[model samples]
Target: MYFDIAYYFRVLRHVWSLKQWPGKRGMLFRLLLVVPLVSAFHALCFLLDYVFFPRLWRQTVERPVFIIGHARSGTTLAHRLLAADGNQFSYFLYWELFFPSLLQKKLIRALGRLDALLGSPCLTRLQRWDDKTFGPTRHIHHMSLWNAEEDQFVMRAAFVTQQWALDVPMMDKIDLFHLDQMSDKKRRRWLHHYRECVKRQLLLNGGERTHLSKNPLMCGWVAALQETFPDARFVVMLRNPNECIPSTLRLLELSWKGRGWQPEQYRESLRVMTEISFESIRHPREVLAGHDQAVFVDYRKLVAEPRDTVHEVYAALGLTVSPSFDAYLRAQQDRERNHQSRFTYNIDDYAVSVDDIEGELSELFDEYQWPRLSRRSDLVKSVGP
Candidate 1:
């Protein structure tokens, strides 16, 4: 009952103010009071952040490093492991997931100072000091830690909405692939917006040489990406569709519950997400034709031996193994000790049958060594909590 109520409210929060809710704008207008209030809060945050924190310029230079694979394929685990090298560039744990950079760039140092002054750095329990994050996520827009994270960028920028995200539309019209036919003029514009955003991140963090980012959108645009970043390396995490789909469905269900209020209302969205499940197998070989650095790391393997797997990943990405990297890796493990406690879910409702799972992920199962389960037992010991 509690889950149901919480889920409904979440959906309301997501859909209430968006395109679906009609009277929401009126509330937003009435909440103009919040603008000034938040502005003051933001400005005060700015003064504090600017004063205390070292002003960083993002080190988001185009590098051949990446942590990828299909959805739920240890990308987060891998990205977090590689992130430990202070030299390997990445957004800080707080900033990457919470993209509040526009203001942070100018005032994050001061914000920290202010927080210390208050004896409240204002860290949320939600702000895990160490957690693995995977995304081409960058800080582009706000300064509030409440900003939406990376996948939103994929959904909106890639133009892969609920309806046609997986339908294989004309290559030119597809979001990521669309870049292929973009007039040199238009393509550069998108790249510029993207690059500048990344550059801002690099500017904020100094001495970072390699830019390793991850995104599931790359599942379909292997050729175009290789061409764009000719020196770019790939690390596609392979997960069986059976496991990946149910996990993805659960995630989408959670998101929908948080934002839209009713699952029935989001039928199309649920369907879109369901089809996106098989995305990995639909275009696998194209992901890594002959790039030596292009690796397909098994999530299960990494889950079993995280440190060793991470080390292998760094070596594959051509990054040097350093004590600093190991330190960061250790710190991340400590953070994970408590992550599961914060999440609540109903797994019974999420029951994904073996047949349905196989039907969806058959391609990935046949291609990769990802385990296939006839019942949930085969996956029970499959690893990676």
Candidate 2:
């Protein structure tokens, strides 16, 4: 979440690389306003990090657990369950990603104190706003102010994530599938920036807790991550590609709307992300194929039986599931069950064909034994949102 001066400059440089503005004048105007405000905030954050948290910049990360998967594949709930083990795990919160500076942290603490003193609903309002804006498909992916979120935000800040395309439409041209192909010096620099962001979170959590990170976008960076944290454990979530692809398209459509973009503007981005998503699975498979450090969880099993799935995950990772953590997992299951209507996904809504999608993902389905829903009705019956 910490966007330093380097990060801002990287974004600007990427935008400049395009050499052309988006066709729409209004969109261009809005981008003009957004660029400066966001860059100013990031510059201020860089000043805060440099001036106040030198110790955090030096903190070392060790053996963190990563939750990886394609978009909407249950990584969020999985991360949430793992983070429930308060004694063993700590993660970056959604709000922390936005206000990552030491100064912002103090400001957040002051706001919390003020809320408590005045019996205000500031936190509640923020959660509601997040649910409405980011969690359009709340059942599929619910983002909140306090929930443990994907580290992609941090990666974006370091200019190492494909998510930058969402903000700067020109970035859709970047080939995110080949991050491992980056020059060693450039890759190392990006890794250092990424690690510093994680280190800040570790230092915030008192430097003793094991970091637990979830980022579907990181699936493609598996090789690099392995090189950086040799002992870190990985959990890969697998979902039926026939369902995952269209669901991802829907999410991208919503995101594009935020930028005042039309459907065509996002078609290229969608295709690239989908192609990258398939290639991403190959990374962990190649890196941790026979290694005990990696665990693969089926998405259907996770949603159908979260508690049992979580227990198996903990066992696979060689971590004990504390009674408190188990209780929290079960409670989360009940809550999700009651909110089932929130998770609705329909393949028919997207432009992709069932047969085409299945063919594209044939290797994945064959490898994972994921059922291929060939017909529209079958897809509708298989999943809700």
Candidate 3:
């Protein structure tokens, strides 16, 4: 996202606050290259906003729909299903996270059109490369430049996000626990940058559609989000911690590999998992307690009964599921049935036991009567007397 020189400096200053480097010379060199490229883009965005699109800052955002939970809790799938109701949701793409300026987005679109007209395979090649890298984990989480992405990447532009910890080992310090203690002024600044990016996406979508974001990081920012968008609606996805934690660690390791950076081992992964699980359990309670518009969708229900789940989500949010949206959902479900995941796991993958996960998430599982690890098979069956 575009920001002023001052904001860029603030973010850089935070990056420099790291007292340790958790990578080799190669990762350090990559960061050197990234620094100047981002700096140039930042300056260019400043000029473009001031000279051409000053009105973007004035665009108002309405009741945005936030899809939030711990990572790998079906957030990507849920976001994909919801965004397919294109008439109702204005969304962010994976590439937009890197170039969030209005001018940059226009340039990307123009280049895409030119590539198509010239019969060039540049864009197709990139998508294929993404497929090759991400296809194996498609059942867990998927990524592409064109698909709806988590807002945490956009928040990374402000240099305050857990996503940053994946590559920049120094960023590991800013987990949910650390963020909860962030100064009020710094927290506000971070959220303001987040707002600026979301507003720009809304402007690009022509300003009428409701903005839909699938930012798992926002799970820890329920209080801040409430303060900013008092009318925003939330869809909190619920999955067993036994499954979510290891899969999340797998995703983080893959992210590091994709970026040519090194991934942290057991200790860091455990720290992230414990904190995210705690927040995943607690954040929904905070949101539902403070707002009348929040809804929780069980991951089991979503995977087993996609159609009914979507209907219930719409009803909870007081929105209608258009016929076209329903058709899209059914088609996707039919196609995926042929390729459903056989992937399974045990809590031992994360160097933790079932008792540990239960202890960490005791309140949530007990409150909801969620099935324990041994009985997770019942998730696929319909719940009835």
Candidate 4:
């Protein structure tokens, strides 16, 4: 409901200055027409929620769990695994993020129930559409409307999300990642709005379950989040920069290509993103070091021994794994053992090098014993998909 009018106009001007291409034109159209229209509609619905669901104001977000990490780290795996404990947590499903208003969500649920009663024709069609929309990137990052997803999309309508960089490649101009650097007034405004959204979700999910959120870009907001939710718990997912950096660059390159951006258009943005990736690894650990409520997860262990890793995480957070969730974890063991990533990446393809990564994060590399590539041929090999 809190539209970033200045940021929206700034992006609009930048997008308009670009030379016309099919992709640029499409983005221009969305920037000028589609986004504004949708934002207005969402704002209207958000206002109506106060009158229709007044109890939402009484809901409190207490002891929420936040999962933060660099992109393409094991954040998604950890989030989904914890989300499977549905009785203990409430999260934003991919589709629910699009409808942030409590009234709209309630209405959609009622309609979904009716659709189910009528043989699920609508649900089936939605699934087909979801597959078609996300199928191409499935290997890069598995996506589903029903799956618990990053909560950053809750701010998309407000034009405050990093997701726009995927379509516009304007990361050099946009500063969505640096909440800790923003003016105090602006930082508090955005976090207040975000907290309101979380409260709405908490109320929607029966008003008792702990709010669970996973956002890789939240690495920048560690301080702000702590200030906003003093009782919040954190899980920091870590992987070798040798692996995450290139994989993140590859994903961004593919997204920009799909959106019709040329290499020259996005090359600088990619460089900026690479630097941010390094900080994403360093910032959270430095800030949360020795903090009792924060736990760090190694990517290798998370993927190779998910159940054990999750058990350790639960113990660290003073949470008990329920019988049903324990059974779910046991069922996932064979699947985790057999899992493999279809996507592949080479570190040499990006602007940064292994030496640069190690030079900047030598402590992490040494602490985790992340293997180093000694030759160019080894660097070309997959780090871990």
Model 4 spans with C-alpha error above 4 angstroms: 381-385
In TM-score terms, candidate 1 sits at: 0.64
Q: What lDDT, from 0 to 1, does candidate 3 have?
A: 0.69
Q: Write the per-residue lDDT of candidate 4 for residues 1-385, one digit (tens) a residue.
A: 7998888988888878877655667888888889989999999998998889889768899999999999878899899999999999999999999888888899999999999999999999999999999998776678989989999889887888877777788899888888987988878888888998898999999999999999999998998899999999999999988888888898889889877688998999998998899889988998898899999999989888999999999999989999999999999988877787778888877778889888999998899999987788877644342
Give the Å shift of residue 159 in candidate 3. 2.6
* Top candidate (TM-score): 4
Please give the lDDT score for candidate 4: 0.88
Candidate 3: residue pairs that collide: none
- The candidate with the higher TM-score, 1 or 3, is 3
Writing each residue's lDDT as its tens digit, candidate 3 over 42-87 gives: 6578458646777775788889899988776778778888988888
Candidates 3 and 4, the one with greater lDDT: 4
Native-to-model Cα distance after best TM-score fit, residue 51 in candidate 4, in Å: 0.9
Model 2 lDDT per residue over 117-216, tens place: 8776987787688768777555556667777887657555434555556765543556555657777765666666677677777877787888899987
Worst 10 residues of 2 by lDDT: 1-10
Q: Report the number of clashing residue pairs per model.
A: 37, 6, 0, 0
Who is ahead in lDDT, 2 or 4? Answer: 4
Please, what are the lDDT tens digits per residue for candidate 1 over residues 1-385? 0011232233335434366654456545533454345445544543454345444332336664655556665665566556556576554343442233444544656766777787654653324432223221221111224332232142222222322222211122233433445466544544544544455455555535666676565565555556656787777787656555566566566555654447565556555545545655456455576668677777666665667767776687776777877876666664544333222233335445567667765666776766666554354322132
Computed on alpha carbons, the lDDT of every model, listed in order, comes to 0.50, 0.71, 0.69, 0.88
Cα RMSDs of all predictions? Answer: 9.7, 3.8, 4.7, 1.4
